[model samples]
Target: MSIVWYYDFISPFAWLQWPKIKALAAEHPITLRPILLAGILDLCGQKGPAEIPAKREFTYRYTLWRARQAGVTLNFPPSHPFNPLAALRLCIAAGSSGAATEAIFDWIWGHGRAGDSIEALAPVAAALGIDDPVAAIADPAVKAQLRENFDAAVAEGVFGVPTLSIDGRLFWGDDAHEFALACLRDPSLWNEPEMQRVAALPIGAARQA
Candidate 1:
């Protein structure tokens, strides 16, 4: 079986889950799908927890704690909510190699760089041996591809990063890693009768009449 991983580099939780997924990739086929987290939030009409004043602090602290717990390195960028469009387009340019994706993730979340400017992204592009990243990001084809990925993600019901999906089953967030691995081990779990019935329950209503 194969897994589709939806991610955005700006997501710290995605950063934390990076190593785990990389290791998991060895045992399962994984296709990396990059989309703009901001775009997803916009489509869902939902504000990220970090966008809330009260939750922002806790989210940051908890992200750090989880990073420590996972033995993953994480540092918030110099600023919050910086645009990662260029870096993301670069990933599209790079053809979404796990190494390339992780390199950008690490640079932003691990090194805490303000990846908002093309100047900031220069070294990352140079290190990856990508010529003229600015031009690549400027390429209408690359821009269209990123938009397509975002549109595909929204259509697939993806609401967040690090979402693992197969055959219409979704396992969201970093905490669901092991559960995803388990489902991979037993594909039948994807269609258990009782679970399917439960999934059919109407939203905001406990029982269907």
Candidate 2:
């Protein structure tokens, strides 16, 4: 089976990790799965880093720092926390190819452009040889595929974008890319006693809702 990468256009971390993931794809099969970050956050009853004022500033700074460290060009769109639904659907409509995925990422994070609406994403569609992104994203099939991807992500216990799933193991965040590769290189790592112990650790405290 191919390694599954769950991502959202709203995530700069995803954009940061894309290059490494694409490099990995040169040697291994990787599947691009576009998901709604908001849906996952809602399902888990948590706010995104951007949703929290202090965290938002830090997230932006930290991500930029990371990009610089990785020698990757980084730029935030004019507005953030913008709706990614249209862009997500466009990916699905475009058959989720690596080229299309890279193009979309470049359009958003690389160029610092807003992709919240079909009209805004017209250039991306045109680049992908899609005549009408508006119609493409409006298709019922495209909408359903995006929902299916979200549901699959939830089922996989995915909590965030830039998550890599390999052999039923999830490595979350751009920082976890090396961890994912390590696990892939040594699947037995998960079989360690400490790994099992941590996996079964019981919650000792709870916050009342």
Best by TM-score: 2
Task: State the local distance difference test value for candidate 1.
Answer: 0.84
**Candidate 2 C-alpha lDDT tens digits along 51-128:** 999999999999999999999999999899899998999999999889889999999999999899988999999999
> Across residues 1-209, which tens digit of lDDT does each residue of candidate 1 receive?
54788888878888888888889888778888888898889877789877998899999999999988888888899988778788888888888888789778878998998778778988888888888988878989988988888887777799888798775578889999888878878988867999799989778856443
Q: Note the residue pairs that clash in candidate 1.
A: none
Q: Which ten residues in a row have the lowest lDDT in candidate 2?
A: 160-169
Cα lDDT, model 2, residue 101: 92
